[model samples]
Target chain A: MSEHIRIVLVNTTHPGNIGGVARAMKNMGLSDLCLVSPKLFPHPDADARASGATDVLESAQVVASIDEALADCELVFGTSARERHIPWPLVDPRELAAIAAPLKGKAKVAIMFGREDRGLTNEELQRCHHHVHIPAVESFSSLNIAAAVQVISYELRMAELADQAGEKPQWGTQWDIELAEQRELELMFEHLERTLVKIDFLDPDNPRQLMPRLRRLLQRAVPDKVEVNVLRGILKAVERKMESAEKNGNDHV
Target chain B: MSEHIRIVLVNTTHPGNIGGVARAMKNMGLSDLCLVSPKLFPHPDADARASGATDVLESAQVVASIDEALADCELVFGTSARERHIPWPLVDPRELAAIAAPLKGKAKVAIMFGREDRGLTNEELQRCHHHVHIPAVESFSSLNIAAAVQVISYELRMAELADQAGEKPQWGTQWDIELAEQRELELMFEHLERTLVKIDFLDPDNPRQLMPRLRRLLQRAVPDKVEVNVLRGILKAVERKMESAEKNGNDHV
Candidate 1:
């Protein structure tokens, strides 16, 4: 259970927070730590703040992109503090632990903590299986990044200690159905957007939120591999129809 | 149940933690806050950290000591991260909320959090009827003060939301024996102090906190109107006995 959990920090600016997060992870008896394009690491501030938990800092894997950080993780969760214009499939920390707990022996679980101020970019967020929110005072919900790690780490420890893998809600992500990987999903999304543009249904210049909304809806739906292929097939058909229409119009000209 | 719960932080040194606590408190819809001897209140750090929870901080009752913080509270629970030598009746966060849930409307409940480094003092620990521990990783269990508040507040909110108080562990107050006003309680405290002085049992000049200790004891009991009247009657009798003894001493002199 300990080794299966991957705690990822994305684009973290503060070296102290990286150290703080390492300390938090070690406290919870978790070892695997990953960083994606962090601005400062291997710095004295991180070493100083890590205090006695320098081992975690030394072994942390620093990656160039989120995809690389989360490539092998079967179940990925991102911590989201603020609600977007469109909602994603969100769970509180406790529920997330319950969901992740069951995947202990079966899957590698990665929990992502975003940057201090801007949080995870929309592209990074859509890569996650679930968006976990630590409930806070709504009006003033400015939770520190490392502190967020602490709370989630605490929950993960509790769930692991409780060994509640069997009771997690059935999210339909069972053994029979394979989930579409982020790369494939991103390709499908690009195809869908292009098809929408070619059909004149979506304005590229004034594309307010057509793609992100679709992404959100599809992300929540968490389409399986088969479903992703079905969606891609539908988009290809629409693209061909537009191509044929354009050719007939050219003939008219 | 929400109205009955008061979140108290004692001797908090960091304004950011205070703001964080305020935000956490607001997230759980538990607004009643009492700060005992905070080092740096009205600081911008707290306001900045509080995000939008300034109202919770603004309406927060800033008190001089834990006694005044719990002055009107009928049930008090202090959070302790580690085990103490003297075992107080302890409950995890959820159980504490369950115990406090039933006391709603009948008694005001206060949950105390100590300073970051040295949790609640033994003397402060003694003031509470029960001790609450938020289960955490023991190796690195130094949870930031606000996060601890967030976890407990979350539990309190869940218990309240389960809405068990309305049906379970009935406190029998059901609109009977109106609680004495805080003003009346203060007046009673004054009278009791004056009478104790007249009896030569207490020295006003060298007061060793006899009145405050008594106030702490009585506040936790949260006596209702009838009980208050009975205590007042007893105090009046003691006052009369002191007067008669003084008169006899005068005659003998």
Candidate 2:
């Protein structure tokens, strides 16, 4: 159950925090750690903080970008410390656990924690199917990066245990269709944006939050690979229709 | 509800751990903290590690003993990393929160964490009415004390929020009778043990697991103040009867 899920830390500033995250993940039975553009790694501070979980740190995959970290993941969750204006499907850690638990062996899940100072950027958050916020006290809401990971990882373990004990209802829908991977979703988003521009429904120059809103809508639906392909095919057909109208000098319609 | 609960760390080795625990507690909306004979307190390491929770560290109580830390608490939960031979009422962190959350405002609760090297001693474990064990992976079960605290405190906050949202059933049984406080339970145990020895039922020199077994039984019942009083009354009555029989030269009978 733990093997299918990965912890992704993006632009982490502190090496010690990376070590702490490794320890937290290992403690919660999770071993897959991916560091995306971490400021420091393979540092002594991280090794010291990792304690007995140096193996996790040693085996961690350090990637240059969030896209590379999450490209192959079927499900992605972005951790947010503060609320964003974008109305994405925001869930607490426990809720995320419930949603993610039954996906074990069926999907590759990636949970992303951002930098020490600023959390995941709006652009990074858009890549996630859901945003997870740890329910910390609002006044002193910011938790240590490792502590936040610990809380989420702990919930995942608890949910996994509950699932193993047959206490939790199977949350995953019995979809014979394979879910679209992150890279597939990215491609579909590109196609969507291009089609929206060609249809004159979206102003490419002044695209404020339209793309993000659309992303949220599509991400919430969690389209399968075939669904994504179908959506792209439709976008291509719309482009073809627009091109024919332009060639016939009837683009006004 | 969070106010009524205090986190107690027993003989923690590192000052940094103390700070980390404070941050974890504050993040989870818990303020009360009591450290029982930590190796170092008010150290720079602790303050550095506390992040923004310096207030919690500053206001933390430095007690002399676990008994002192738990003296006023109506309920005590000791975190154990390994299983003990004693058949006590053991619960996972979520289960502990389910049982502890409803006691908010009604009871003062103490959750104890032990040293970094070794967890709560058997003698210290006996002091707790119940034991909480985080379900970490058995092979690498030991968690950083702060991570452990974070997991437990997170559950507590989750349970409290769940209770507030009316999603959880009222778990606290409406007891008109006040529950036995830690000191009251301790006194009752002393009286029971003395009475047993007086009645030749328990030998003080070779008292193996008798007291711990009895403690487990009584702790599981979670007797109220009146119940503890009644039990002490019975022990007193038996002692009085034995004294009179001894005075009348019929001690054997």
**Which candidate ranks first by TM-score, i.e. highest?**
2
Best by lDDT: 2
What TM-score quantifies how close candidate 1 is to the native fold?
A: 0.64
Regions more than 4 Å wrong, model 2: A166-173, A248-253, B166-253
For model 1, the stretches where C-alpha displacement exceeds 4 angstroms are: A13-20, A42-54, A81-86, A164-253, B1-3, B13-16, B38-48, B51-64, B101-104, B160-253
Compared with the true structure, all predictions reach lDDT values of 0.74, 0.82
- As a whole number from 0 to 100, the lDDT of residue A243 in candidate 2 is 50
DockQ score for model 1, please?
0.06
- TM-score of chain B for predicted candidate 2: 0.65
How accurate locally is residue A190 in candidate 2, as Cα lDDT from 0 to 100?
91
